[model samples]
Target: MQEWQNACQIAAESAWGVTTDATSVQSMAYDAVRDGTSLKSQHAILATHRVADTLRSITEKHDRGWDAPKPRFTSPTVVYDERSMSFLDDGTVSLATTEGRVSATLRLPDKKDGYQQQYLDDEAWEHTQSTLHERDGAFFLHIGFKKPAEPSRQPEYGTVLGVDLGIDNIAVTSTAQFFSGSELEHRRRQFRRKRRRLKETGTRSALRTLIGIENKERRIAREILHRVSNGIVAEAERYCCDIIAFEALDGIRNRLPAGDVFHSWAFRRLIEYTTYKARSAGIRVTRVSPEYTSQRCAECGHVEEANRSSRDEFVCQSCNARSNADYNAAKNIGERAVRCVQQSTQRTSVSRYALKSGTVTPDEGFTPRDGGVRG
Candidate 1:
């Protein structure tokens, strides 16, 4: 497996060095490296997929008028397709390697309700591709499966839940729920301090400790994100929300306050996690422009920088309405999503915004009314 990974990495580097086009990179890379490695034809071809993916990413950035550096594969994983891999009835997987074919026992999860079990039990899902991953001297196989998606609910009749992401508060919902980032930030600071001390020590043992610390920090962040995402989905479900909305993350760094540390990837991951979870609950996720969401008043629709008195407090200058800044922004995001869906070409009828009190049409504005359907 290690030999296969190393060969794939070299082939990917060669492919990336030769061509920038994703369509032809696979064949060109295969032709160049097929004679060099003992890997089977299909396995060599699969290795070029990594190079093609990187080139496609670079091309997308270029199309968006952004500069992106060439990707360098530090630790490449070997990809296996049907031709190079097979699952036997004896609970073993036959995989093509640089040293030739090898069979390994498949370690099925013990949990009956686990994702692997659920997919394996479902006849509708068909196995697609799988990747071999190496971590801490252990090898694991990640299998992929695909099935038809359920029909989406029409936005015209959907209830929208807005979510605001920030540095201080990891996430804030229009429903008045907040996930604080204080603990995460404190843990990150501690990790940074420990890493600094380890670097100062400049010992082999210290370097190993630093690596372990980094891994632990990643695990902590991932766990927190999962919990926060789950909570966000649960909030939407509690309100019977059909759509979950968020501010678009493009140019988010510029929108944030100066000198504030932002983890763009974390925010993106949160959105991705929420999307998959929401889909399972028959909810759709959408994004709206971030422009003035923080400044705009959820009550009077007033837009002013003075409305936000601090990182945590939002006092509307026009109506003197006081609330958490993140909550206010979330409301604005939800309102924008409602407007967007209402104005969409697919929406021929009036669309309503979901609030804690009830649902209101765009004509009624965001004002709270008495005695209506509960959100």
Candidate 2:
């Protein structure tokens, strides 16, 4: 496996430095792995595929108007399809290595009782590919698979669950649920203080310990975010919510100082996990513009910056309404999501009429002017 990764590393470096052309890079490095190494012919081909994938990603990023630099590999991982690996009956996986084909027993975690049968059944679940990686002195296998998506049992009439993600509490829901982190925040501050002390000491051991602490913190944060997301999704399910709404929080860092506070908050990961879990349970996830959500009053259609008296307080000057700032924002997000859905439905109807009347054109498509429904 190490030999295979070394070959791939060479191939990747060649692809980035020598030429961006994947075919030429593959052709150049193919002989090195094929003739000089003990790696099988198929394994060598897979190495070339990895090089091609890296080059393709760079090219795609550039084409998308990103000033992407040539990528250099930082870690070694092997991607294998069913053709290059096999799953044994006794819950073991056999994969090709540079030495030879080797088999390993998979130590899978216990799954939910109801999902166990469905996950093990071939008709409902299908393994597509797998990747093997080493992390923190442990080898792990991440397998991708296809499963039958449950039919959406969306409620015809149900509440909208709004979630506001922030650095203070991690997440706040429209249902007045607060996932606080007072203790967690204090622990993180302790970690930060320790990190500063280690940096001041400037010793090799301290630096190494700092790195280990950072890794440990990251793992803890990831696990906590997963739990929080799960709880949010579970809340939505409990309330019989039809839609889970979140703010479109792209480029928010540019608007605020991106220090340790912002970096430590795993808002994006929380949302990603929440949406994934919601989708599996047939819940609709919606993103609405976050403009003035915090300032706007959920009790009334009042909009003013002064409505936000403080970071954690919201007292509307117009209607004298009061609530938790994050809760109000979450409520506003839910309202916006409802409006967005309504607008979308209106646009669909208008487009259908235009199509029937032969008024729709291929070039211009549909515009805001084409939509008749307006607030």
Q: Which 10 successive residues of model 1 have the least lDDT summed?
A: 148-157
* CA-lDDT, candidates in order: 0.75, 0.67
lDDT of 1: 0.75
- Across 321-367, the per-residue lDDT of candidate 1 in tens digits comes to 99989988988888888888667764322256556666555557654
Judged by lDDT, which candidate is best? Answer: 1
Clash count, candidate 2: 0
Q: Count the backbone clashes (under 3 Å) in each candidate.
A: 0, 0
Residue 287, model 1: lDDT of 88
User: Which pairs of residues collide in model 1?
Assistant: none
lDDT of 2 by residue, 1-375 (tens): 576666677777666655544467778888876765677777777777777667755654543345777555557577777677877889788888766688998777657544433454566677756788988878787776766433322232334677887767778887667898664566678888999999999999999999988876766666677678888888776654667888886633433455745343576667776776686666767778888888898767699999999989999999999988988887777667666665575221111101111221112332122332112
